[model samples]
Target chain A: MSTLQGAGVHGAASWRITRILSLRWIVWGAAAIFFLNLLGVIAVVIANSFATHWFGSWLPAGWTLKYYAQSWQNYQLSGILVVTLQVAFAAVIVSLLIGTPAAYALARRNFPGKRLMMLAFLLPIMVPPITYGIPLATLLYKLHLGGTLTGVVIANLVPPVPFVILVMTPFIEQIDPRIEAAARMCGAKTWQVFLRVLAPLLVPGLLAAALLVLIQTVALFELTFLVSGPGSQTLVVALYYAVFASGIRPAQAISAMAVIYMLTTLVVLVVTLRYVRPTQMVGTVR
Target chain B: MTLSETPVASEAIAGPERRSLRHRLADRGVDRLLLLSLPASLFVLVFFIYPSIYGVVLSFRPLKPVGAFGNYTHFFGDPFLRGSIVNTFRIALPAAIFNVLAAIPLAVVMRGAVKGQRIINTILVIPISLGTVLVADGLLNYLGPNGWFNRVLMAAGLIGHPLQLLHNQWGVMLSLVITGFPFAFLLTLSYISGIDPKMESAAATLGAGPWRQFWHVTLPLLVPGLAITFCLSFVLAFSVFPSATMLGNPNGDSHVLAVAAANTAFQQYDFPMASTISVIAAAIELLVIGAVLGLRSRFYAGTTTGKG
Candidate 1:
C-alpha cells in the first residue's frame, strides 16, 4: 500500500491526501477562531464602553454616552491630549531636523565605523525600550529635565530618531544623486542643494518618517510612563493612571478611555499602513 | 550681438572658475554632511548609551558588602524578588515557543488565495498596535468571571464553574500570544513567500505525498527563518510587564522581574538593586540572543550566501 516509487504526490488518492486537505481546513478553522477572538474582544470593550448596564446577559442591558462624557470630565483628557501632541510633535520635528541630513550622509557615503554606527542606531529599536528607560529617566532627573514635558520628549526621542534614520536612509539612497551634482555645478551650496534639489523629492519620505515617529511616540508607554510626572503625562500614561489610581470606578468609564486611546492610535495607524507595510518598517523578512 | 557675444566669451573664461568652484564645494561638502550624524549620535550616546552604561555600573555598586554582590544579594535575598526571575521565564518561555509554532501552520494555511486574506492580515496586525496595556484591559473583561467568554460557555453548558482565567499565569501567556502571534506570523509569511513555489510542486510531481513534500523540502529551507522569528518572539515575551500586572497576580504568582525592577527604582528608591535587576534582565536576554544566533549560523551555514 505504501511504496517509495508511488510515495510521491502523483499517487493522488491515498488516505494521506484526504487527511492533508482536512488538516488544511483545520488550520483555517483555527485561524478563523483567532481572528474572531481578536475582533470579539474588541467588540466587547467597545460595547461595554457605551453600555449603561451590562449585567448577567449576553449583551448589555442598555447603552448610553454617559460614560464617555464622565470619562472626559473625570479624567481630564483634554490636557493629556495636549501633552501627547506636544511630545509626539516635538519628537517628530527634532528627529527630522537631525535624522534626515544624517540619513543622507549615511546613504551616500562610505565611512569607517559606518556599520558600527548603524548598529548603534539599530540597538534602541531592536532591544526593549524598558531596558534603557530606567537610566534615561534617572539621567533626565539628574539634568533637571526629568518629570517635565521636556524630559518625556527627550526619553521618547531615543527610539524613533533611530527609526526615522532607518526609514529615511533607504529613501535617500533611492534618489538620483546626479541632480544634486547638477545643482552644485550651477553654484548651489550644500544647504541650497539639499533644500532646492533633494528636499522636494524627499517630501513624501519625510512625511512618512514623521508620521511613523508620531504614532510610535503616542503609543510608546514604557518610556513615557517611566519619565512622566503628574502634570506632564501623555494620553497613554494618563490612561494607565486613570485605570489604576482609584477605587470604586465604573468599568464603562475605563472602557471609554480605552476606546479613545484605541481610536486615536487606529486613525494614525490606518494612515501609516497606507504608506508602508509592517515588513518595510523592520526590513524585508524575505 | 554684444549680449550674445559677451555672454559666450565670459562663459569660456569662467569655465575654469566653475570647475574649480565645484571641486572646492564637493571637497568641503562631505565633511559638512558627515557632521549631520553627530547630533543624532550624540543624542543616542548621551541619552541612550550613557544611561544604560550608568545603570549597569550603578548595579555593580556595593550593597553592604555582605554577599557575593550587594545589589544582587539584596535582590535575590527576598523570595518574592527571586521568584520574579523564575516567573518571567515561566511566562516568556511557553509564550514564545507556542506563538512561533502556532504561526507556522496558520502561515502555510493562509498562503494560498483565501477569501479575505487582506482583511485577515489587517486584523492580525491590529493587536500589535493595541499595545500591552489596552490588550490587558480588554483581556480583563473577556477572561474575567462574568465576561462574555464565560457567559457563552455557561450558556452552552460546556462547563459548570467559571474559570479563574485572569490574574494568573494563563492570562499573561495568552496576552503575550495575542501580541506576539501577529508579529511571528508576519515574519513567517514573508519568509515562506521567499521560497521557490516550484520546488514544492516538483516534489509533488515526483510522487512524494504532501506530508513528505513539506517535511523533506519546505521544512528544511524554513529553519533559518524560524530561528529568527523564534528569537524575536523571545525578546518580545521576555519584556512582558504591563500585561503581567493587568492580567496576573501583581505581587503573587505572576510577579515578573520587570515589575520588581520598576519597584526597586521607583517605589523603593533602591537604585542599586534596581540597576542590578536591569542588568540581569539585559544579560539574560543577550544570552538567549547569542544562543539563537549561534544556531542560526549552523542552520544557515550552507543555506545562505552573500550575508557573510
Candidate 2:
C-alpha cells in the first residue's frame, strides 16, 4: 500500500507538470511557426547565394561560393557600398547640426508656441513618407535640385531631423539648466555656457541621435528613389535595378550585398544597445 | 579671464538704464533665434509646402500648355482608375486584418516568460530592415517554379506539378504579410508588455481559467495598442509598390494608388493625373490617421480615469 501511494503521488505531480508543459509547448509551437515564416525568406536567400545548383530538392545538391563571387565581380557591390556610406554620413551630420539646438530649445524653454513647435517636429513621423516624397520631388524638379545628391540628402532631412529631435528631447530635459545659469552668473557668455556646459552632458544623446539618423539614412528608399537620378544611385536603388533591371543572377549578388548591409546594421544596433539606454532617456523626460 | 578690480562704472549706471539694456539683450537673443530658424523654415516652405500646393494645383489643371480641370475630369471618367481604388482596399484591408489578428497571438507568446525571447525577437525584426526589393527577391526564389516548397510537396506526393505562388494577387499578399507582420508584431508586443501582470494573476486567483483570464483581463487593455498597430500596418500595406510590381501582375489588376501615381507621372508623363491621385492618397491617409489619433485620446481618457 505504501509503494502504491508513492507511485500515485509521483503520477499526480507528473500529470500537473505535463499539463503546464503542454501549454508551453502549444504556445511555443505556434510561435516557432510564425518565426520560421518570418525568417524563412532570409534563409532561402542565403541558401540560394551559396547553392551551386538546387532546384527540385529540399536542400541544395551542392554548395559553393561561386554565385556570390560571380555576383561581386559583375555588380560592383563595393562601389554601391561607398555611395551608401557617403550619403548616410552626410545626412547624419546635417541632421545633427540642425536638430541639436532645436531639441535643446524645446526641452529647456517654456515659451509660447512650444506645443505647436513640438507638433511640427512630430508630424513627419506620423505622416507617410510617400505623401511627402511625391510633392517634394516635384518641388525639387522645379528648383533644379532633382537628380542631385544634395536633393536626396535634403529630402532625407525631413524624417531624420524629426527623429533626432524626438530622441534627443528626453535626454536634453534631464540636464539641469542651473549649471548653465551658474556659468552665466560666473560671467560666461551664452554661447560659452552652451558649448562648455550643456553640450558635454548631451554627448550620449547626440551619439544616439547620430547613429539613428545614420541607420535611417541608409535604410531610406522612397525619398532617394524619387529624387536620385542615375548618377546619384544608392545601394537600395541599385538593388531595385538589379532585381528588376537585371535578372535573377545579378539580383542574388545584390541580395549578398544586402546581407553585408544588414551586418553593418547589426554592428550599429549592438553599439547603440551597449552605449545608449533608451529607457534612461525616456525616464528623464517623465 | 581674471576679474578686473576696477569698479566698472556700476555706480554711474542707474537701475532703470541697466534694466532696459538687459531687456534689449533678451530681445536681441530672441530675434537671433528666430533669424536662425529662417533658413530651415524657408527650405521647408519652398520645398515641402510649395510642392504640396503645386500637387493640388496640378491635379486641377490639364496636361496641355493651357490649364483646365480636364485631368480631374479625365480621371473620374476612367473606369480603370476607379477599379484601382477598389483593388487597393481589397488588398490592403484583408492584409491589415490578417496581420493584426496574427500579431495578437504572436505578441502574447512573445510577452510570456519564454526561453530565447530575445533571439526570437531579433529574428522577427530581421525582415523589417530588409525592405521590399530584397524580400521580393527572396520570395521569387522560394515561391517561383522549381522552388523549395514545390520540391518538398512533390517528394511528399502532395502534388505532381509546381504551385503558381507568384505573379498573382496571392503572391503580392504573401509578400506584404511577410514584410508587414514584423511591424505589427513588435508594436503589439510593446503595448501588451506594458500591461500589469498582476491583473492576469488576480483573475486566475478569482477562479478564472487561462482563456477566461486572457479575455477578461488582457484583451480589453490591449485595444489602444491594437488600434494603433492596425492603422499603421494598414497604411503600410496600402501603399504597396515594389512587391506588387515585382511579384504580381501590375498591368492594372495589382496597380495600387502609389503604383498608379507612378504610372501616370513617370511612365505616361501625365503629371496632372498623377498629382491628383497622390493628393487623394495623402488626403485619405491624413483622415484615417486623424481618426486613429482621436480614438487613442478617447481610450486613454476612459481607461486612465482622466489622470493622464
Candidate 3:
C-alpha cells in the first residue's frame, strides 16, 4: 500500500511544511549576512587606507596612494619589517629543532606517561598567554631578557613549539613504518633513517609547521608587547603602538600600514593552505 | 637483519618479535627519543613552567610581609578592582558562546559543496590571521560612528541617531567575535566534515528528514568538537587586553581581567598584586574550562572518533 501525502491532504497543517521551508531560508540568510560582515570588516579597512575622507558615505570620499607613502615614511616599515623577519625566522628554527624530534618520539613510540606528556605539550598553547605572560615577562625583565629581541623570541617559543609538535605528530604518524624498516635493512641507523628516509617525507609537514609558526610569531602581540623593548617591536606590536600613538595622523596612513601587514600574512597564508588544510591548523589540537 | 618469516598477518605477528636485529636499531632511535625531546622540555620548563610557578608564588607574597592573603585581599577585597572579575566573565562567557554558535551553521553551510568554496574559505580564515588588534582598528573605522555600518543605517533612514557601537564593551565584543568566529568555524568545519557522511545518509534512507537527521545522528558526535572550540574561544576572549583598552569603555566595567593584571603588574609596579590577579584570572579560566569539559564529556558519552 502507498503512504498518504499527509502534508498535501491536510490543508490546516500545510503551514508545517511551509514553516520548515521558510526556516531553512532564514537560516541561510543569516549565514549569508554573517559571511558578508566578516569579509566586509576587512574590506572596510583596506578601502579606508586609500580614502581621503570616508565619513557619511558607503565608499570613501577620495582615493590616493599618498597614505601608503605616509605610512612607509612615518612607520619605519623598513626597520620593522626587518625585525619581524628576524624574530619569525629565529623562532621557527628553534621550534623546529625542538619540536620535530619531540613529535617523532610521540608518534613512533608509545610509552608510559604519554598522555601526561601530550597534555603538558598542550597547556602552553591551550591557556591564554596573558595569564602566564605577566609572569614570564616579569622573569625576563628580572633576568634582563625583557624588551630584547632574544626575550621576544623566547616568549614567542612558548606557544609555537607546541603547535609544531601538534602539527608534526600527525604527519610523523602517517608515515609507514615499513619504509623505515627498509631503510634500516639497507644499514641506515636511526639518525640516518630519520635524516634520509624521513626528512624528505617530512619536508612538506615541516614547511607547513614553519609557515604556521612564522605567521603566529608575526601576529603574536600580547607576549611581544609585554616582553619586547623599543628596539624589538614586531609589525603587530608596532601597529598596536601606532594605534594609540600620540598626534593626529590620517586614518588612511594607518590603514596603509595595516594593509601591508595583511598582505604579508595573506601571502604566507596562501602558501600555507597549499601545504596544509585549515582543519590541520585547528582540529589537530586534540 | 630481515624478519625470519613473512607472516600472513603483519602487526599481529610482529607484536611478539621485538628481538630482531633491526629492532635493536629502531629501539635505539626510540631510546634517543627521550634525548631528542630534551630541548623542548628544557625550553618549556625554563620559560613556561618556572615563570608560571613563580608568578603564582609571588602573588601570595604580601606587600607588608603580613598574611598569606594580603596580595589577593588588596585587590579582591577592594570594590573597584573586584568589579573587573565580574566584568571579565560578562564579556567572556557570552562572547564565547556566541562565537561557537555562529561557527556551527557557517560550518554546516561550508561543508556543503558551495560555489567559490576556496575563495570563501580564504576570506573566512583571513580574520584568524588579522589578530584582535587589527580587527579592533577596523571596527573603529568600519563600525565607528562615521564608519560604513552607521553611514548605511543613516542613509537608509533606519535610525534617527548614530548607534553607540564603539568605545564600549559592545565594540570589544564585536572584535572578539570577528577574531574568534573564524577560528571556531575552522575547527568546527573540520570536525563536522570528519563525521561519516554515510551516517546521515543512512538516517535519510531510513525516512529521516534533514533536521531530524542532524538533530539525531550528527548533533551527538558534534558535542566534543563544539566543547573544545567553546573553551578555546572563551579563553581567547577572556585574555582581553588590547581590544578592551582600544575598543571598550576603559572607565566602565569592561576593564577585564588581563587588563587589570597588566595594570597592576606594570603600571602600578605592584608585582605581587599583579601576580595575584594573574593567578585569579587563571583560576577562573580553568574553572570555566573544567565545567565546559565536564559537560562536553557527559553529552559526548565517548561517541567521538575523530581523534588523530
Clashing pairs in 1: A8-B207, A8-B208, A9-B207, A9-B208
Rank candidates by DockQ, best first. Answer: 3, 1, 2
lDDT of 3 by residue, A1-286 (tens): 0132343657424554566667667767976776777767888989998888876677888888899998999989989999988998999999999999988888888766778888888999998889999899999999998899899989999999888889899889999989999999999998899889999999999998998888788788899988998899998888888887725777788889988988888888888888866666666666
lDDT tens string, model 1, B1-308? 88889989998989989888866766655455688789889988998889999998878785566644877777678888888889999999999999989989887777766677766777777788768888888888898888877877888899898888998999999899898889898888878877787878887898877788777777777888888888888888988888887888878878887888788789978777777888888888999989998988886776544222
Give the candidate order by descending lDDT.
Answer: 3, 1, 2
TM-score of chain B of each: 0.84, 0.80, 0.87
Query: Which has the higher TM-score value, candidate number 1 or candidate number 3?
Result: 3
How well is each residue in B1-308 modelled by candidate 2, as lDDT tens digits? 13452345554466668778867766544434544344444445565666778989878876675457767666667888867777778778899889888888777766867687666666665566557767787787777777765666688999888889888777788888887787787778778878988888887788776667677678878877788888888888888878888888787678788878877867887777888888878777777768987988787666654122
* Candidate 1 residue lDDT tens string, A1-286: 3453375655546656667778988988888787777777788889999999987677899989999999988888888888988998999999998888789889988776788999988888888877777877878888999899899999989988888889889899999988889999999998898788888999999988887787778888999988999889988887777666635578899899999999988988888888766644334322
Off by over 4 Å in 1: A1-17, A281-286, B1-30, B62-68, B112-115, B202-208, B302-308
- As a TM-score, model 2 comes out at 0.83
Taking all chains together, each candidate's TM-score versus the true structure is 0.89, 0.83, 0.89
Candidate 3 CAPRI-style tier: medium
